[model samples]
Target: MTLDLATLFFVTVFMLGLGGVLLLFAWLQNRSTTALAWWGAAFLFFAPATALFGLRDNLPEFWSIVVCNTIYSLAYGLLWTGARVFEGRRPVFLGMTAGSIVWLLASQFSFFMQSLPLRIVLASTIVLTYCLLFVWELWQGRKEGLMSRWPVMAMVGLHGLFFLVRIPSVTSLPFPIGANSPASPAALIMVFGPLFYAFALVFLLMALTKERAELYQRRAANIDSLTGVANRRGFTELALRVIARSNTDKAPLALLLFDLDNFKGINDRFGHRAGDRVLVVFAKTIQQTLRPLDLVGRLGGEEFVALLPGVTPDITMDIAERIRDSFAAAAREVDGHRVSATVSIGTASATQAGYDFDTLYAVADAALYRAKQKGRNRIEPGRPSLTMVSQALES
Candidate 1:
């Protein structure tokens, strides 16, 4: 079988196009992320597109070899960006890749490639340098707890180097590192290159799919299916985390628990449809008023929780006031009429007595009970619950 670079270029095009489609899927499913655009651009223009067209003019020339190797290098580098960023690492790979590709391109000068003595000296040197670099990155990934991420990348990197130097004229140069050996670079690459990179890409897609599925499972576990807010499960999770962090950091956090006033009457008079609309509208209201950094979740029907981190009592009161007014302002219009509802918020801060996630939830719950008992449409806080519990315990 006669294997040529043309066949190689054709197959990479298909793989790159497939990656572009998945990146689009990621962009649409979540909020706008910059990585999606970068991935799309890399696949569309750099990887196979350049290889297909750029290789035509310079076939078997140094530049053709350079272009093909550059694309593969760049693809590995671009693919590494996803590997790093998706797991929250600095974008250092882009700059490093630019430097590496630049140096490799600069070596194509006739003087550089022609010097038999210099070529041999530099060939071993360049090989060692890049091999060390790949090893260093692999070590870093393992140390940083990124999970089994480096293997796929290492496979891409090693195979890429194999494909790069295998250009007919170039493969023999610098005393032909692999040319003199029983195993030829072209033969080895033909045996493994396309399929190796293909396997790496497949591995990456598997990693991405696994990540998305895990994220979905985590979200579903914490969120209410009907209301799309944190359910009791999520509340326990946030509480444990906030409590553990608060004890360590000693920074103030707060929780506001509340329920709508006269909610049942609306359901009784207007129907459960109106009540559900009120819940959705209320969730929307709380979501809008609070900073995106804050977390809000519907605990159950008519009851909600807003976890506010780093807020003092005074600031929290101001927030509570706004939430109260914001909800009243957010009246629902059904079948041509404005239907009004009110809320009673129980607010508690970390610095206060019984200042913890559970205590805050309890206090807020007690305050809500009082708000309903004392007539409704108001705000209360956590001290009341602690006091009642203390008295009951003493009694």
Candidate 2:
């Protein structure tokens, strides 16, 4: 193995392509919209690194210059973007990236036209400074957390080292690569080129995939194990946002608070296992009854909340009443014996209550309490159910 620049470039591009494909698949799985930013780096790596040799030598100076200029710039950008994707911000770095781009352009063209010591000096300064910055980024990443992702940090560090060898010497490849490259012992200009970028692409894809998995895991944590609907925390988060936006748009919002009626009796009569079955069945019935804009969540034992955004009071009430009737019709057969279940529902309309989400929840809760007081298996508005009270007084 000659370990030449040509070989390094080829392997580097190949690795970058592989990384891009992996990252694209991972991002697609998560449906992250920002993942498109990776296409810039992936586009450059579609060809093998050795193919870049022809571009460096064959084309005019400007294209060649652009080619090498973007090499480490894209590498660093990938590291930055990966960090941003993981932590929502770029990690710290010690190098001057603007100077490096200027250096790459100067280095590619200096040999073609003239001998410039000042150019060499400036380029070397950029490379060495970037090396120091790479060390700084690694040190900072270790000290202020993110130590667990050292391999990701190392990907950045190696990129700086790529600049170091490529800049000062301007004629050699990195260590431990290009063992059998055709460009090895052949092309001087192809040394230490985009190999580091390939390194970055792979790491970027891996880091992005890891980020998606973590997000999915976090989402799963906020879901109820039994019904697989959003749990109380996720529901509250969704409801607050909906309420805020509904207020802003002057749109209507509705809250539905419902609980199983005599659920304790079901547990005592049929066993808690049967009670759980009823909860699951009741959840399914409500899910089937909801509109696309509606969100349902189990707050805790036997308690549930629903947020209906952009619906009229009549529609919301109708939907709630339908869910109530449907739940009543659902029969659970345990050990060849059929059992019936019912729910107490209380609803509050934001059109009537004004813009406060907490107020809506409170009013809905009060309504639910009213429903329970009047009789189980009935519906109540946030305000007192005067009709039920009137009927009771008449009785």
When summed lDDT is taken over every stretch of 10 residues in candidate 1, the lowest stretch is 173-182
**Cα lDDT of model 2 by residue, 1-395, tens digit:** 34555456666566666656666665576655343345434334434323543456576754544454345444444444444434444533332246545655666665633543343345445545554554454455454433335665565566556546545453333222222223433344343344454555456546644655676678898899998888999998888888889877999888999999988988899888888888888888889888767899999999999998988788878888999999888844643446678899998887766656666777789989989999889998776344533442343
Candidate 1 at residue 62, lDDT? 52
Query: lDDT per residue, candidate 1, 1-395, as tens digits?
Result: 65565556566666656656666566567543544544554555444634544354556645444455455455545555554455445567655376346647756697865554454344334433444454454456454443444664565466545534443344454323333333445443443444454446555645644555576678798988767878877977777686667757877888888788888888898888878888888888888899987888877888898888788888888899899999888855643446788888888776773344556666677777877788877876656445745543343
Query: What is the Å distance of residue 128 in model 1 from its true position?
Result: 19
TM-score of each: 0.58, 0.53
Give the CA lDDT, 0 to 100, for residue 191 in model 2.
Answer: 39
lDDT of each: 0.63, 0.64
Off by over 4 Å in 2: 1-194, 332-337, 384-395
Q: 4, model 2: CA deviation in Å?
A: 4.0
**Candidate that scores best on lDDT:** 2
Clashes of 1: 1
List runs of model 1 lying over 4 Å from the truth.
1-186, 195-201, 332-336, 384-395
| C-alpha positional error of residue 127 in candidate 1 after TM-score superposition, expressed in Å | 18
